[model samples]
Target: MSSDVIVIGGGIAGLATAHELIRSGASVTILERSRCGLEASWAGAGILSPLLPWDYPQSVARLAQLSNSLFPEFIEALTTETGIDPEYQASGMLVLPELLPESSGDAKGLRQDARNQMAEDWCGRNAFPMTRVRSREIARALARDQEAFWLPGVCQVRNPRLLQALIRAVNLAGGKIVEHTAVAGLRVERGRTQSISTSQGDEYSADHYIVAAGPWSRQLLGEHALKLDIWPVRGQILLFKAQPGLLDTILLQEWDYFYLIPRHDGHILAGSTLEEAGFDKSPTTEARQILLAKAHALVPALTEETVSGHWAGLRPGSPANIPVIDRHPSISNLYLNSGHYRYGVTMAPGSARLLSNIILDKPQPVDVTPYQWPR
Candidate 1:
């Protein structure tokens, strides 16, 4: 089959890109190796904020912020069109005290002072404050006080629902999705991608092609001689069935690199362990135990609830933790939208829109120079 644009992968990045291409009057087809939206996109705890850019470069921060701003309208239009709620909530995030380990006597006071200084610096620069706190005080405050200053503009999305909505919206918008069809190689000739070979022995052609295959992006672009340098970082998360009002906001324990997300339903999702164990999606008991211990320590109430589920997903991690979202240097017709690392779901809409604009030769809503392909 031939189309104006063929997008590989059916996760948020691919689906969003295909959807935007269709909106631009392009005939698009998305091919997924397995099921659509069941990879990193599905496994994400959708935290849509630019707050984690403390160590990221300015280029990444720009895209993340732009994407974060576009989410409101994107979710609204998606829900309106698909009749499926993505559950976009603005519950905010709280940094718990326990994540910041205590130091000794005078050293402890000095460390606290440094933390306060760091918080002040961030607040002055309009960044989220990363500091130390008293875990017990934090627990008591969250449990008893509803009028705390922790509730800000932090937002979240139900990833599964969002993916479903995107799939439905894509289909409704006249975009086609093919599952269990992996692109083995790209047929490039004279510096442009003309066709793609699939594992099922079928050849597909398109006017334009986009590689949004997430962690497997490099595998699909093998024939094109494009070296993406993308690797998979495995992350495992745990789910617990809890009461609705147990935790009102997303909790981040900075030092522990752990987060707790409360869903619309009475469930709390806590995670995750980042391991560089290439493409493995198996959740380890060690990770589960660690997450459970942390969760229980943070919110003692969670001890009463049973562990509902544990799963793992591979994130397409790049060296700099930013996505590659530009046209291939040698192949003019081939575009890349992979390597989003841990923020694929959060950055999908903006990345998709930017890529579509670049493909259509239209003015991008945000700058795209930072996301240009490496030469």
Candidate 2:
């Protein structure tokens, strides 16, 4: 059997891509090994931007910027069509840098004040909403010495709900999804993929093939004589239950790479530890302790909150953390939309739009050179 496009992987990328493809008058089919949207798409924190965009490369920043702009209308349309809210909220982010440089005259070691100034200048230049607030003013839970600032433009979504909405949107748009269907390998002849062989010995083909299988995409490509620097970077996150409004914004400890995201109705999410543990989604006690300690450090009152849950997911990592959003260099009909690492949820809509446009040969809204095949 075949369709206009066969999307391998049913996570956000696949679902969103199929949704867009269907809208563009293309028949779409998605194949998922387990369930769609249950991997990184469901487990992610869903912060709409990187915790600190300044730390990312130009490509990542550009994609995120474009995606963030599209989110408002995207969410609105999805909700209107599918009747799912996705819990989208501009909850904002508060950054608290705990570590400061020593009094050494080394230019490389930036002092606390200098770091704050640099962040402020960057936000100002970018026109992002930011404000410096005394620790005591923002949260009575923090220690006296804790310094923090607010990025009021930062936003978050409930990732599971977002995935649910995407799935509904795809189905309503006449996209076909085959669950528990694993693609064993692709049959490539000459320079184009002819068909995909499944674990159950079923063969499927399409006009074009897309590998959005997340971290597993690397193995899938390798089976076809293609090598991509994509791997699974494990991240563990802990959830806590607290009263709504107990925490005003997303609390982040900058130097520690940990964050506390607040949801409506007394739900708080704290995460995460990035480990290069090969495809292992096991939760570790040591990581839980580290996350709890960071959460308590930021909001001492959180110590009284009940520990709710802990889980891990694999993010599709790539070189320099830039996602591969281009067609396979060798295979004419094989395209890729994976290796988004930690920002898959944030980048899903933009990725889908871009991939669909590329497939349909439409003018892209953003420059495509930086995200081309990593060579």
RMSD of each: 3.1, 2.0
Output the number of the TM-score-best candidate.
2
lDDT of each residue in 1-375, candidate 1, tens digit only: 898998999988999898878877898999899989999999988888643455467777677777878899999989999999999998777664332233454776577556545555654575543333343333452433221124256789999999999999899999988999998887778988879998999999988999998988887677553556788999999999987767677887655668888887878899888899987899998999999998887777776356899999999988687788998888889999988887888788889989998889989877788777765
lDDT for residue 215 in candidate 1, whole number 0-100 = 86
Q: Which tens-of-lDDT digit does each residue in 1-375 have in candidate 2?
A: 999999999988888788878888999999999999999888899899888877778788778888898899889988998999899999888888765446554564456567778788877777778898775676665655555788888989999999999889888888888999999999899999999999999999999999999999989877552557889999998898887888767877777768888888788889988999998898999998988887886677677357889999999998877888889888889999988988988888898899988999999999988777765
| lDDT for residue 201 in candidate 2, whole number 0-100 | 96
Off by over 4 Å in 2: 99-109, 143-145, 223-227
State candidate 2's TM-score: 0.94
Q: Report lDDT per candidate.
A: 0.80, 0.85
Report the alpha-carbon TM-score of model 1 versus the true structure: 0.91
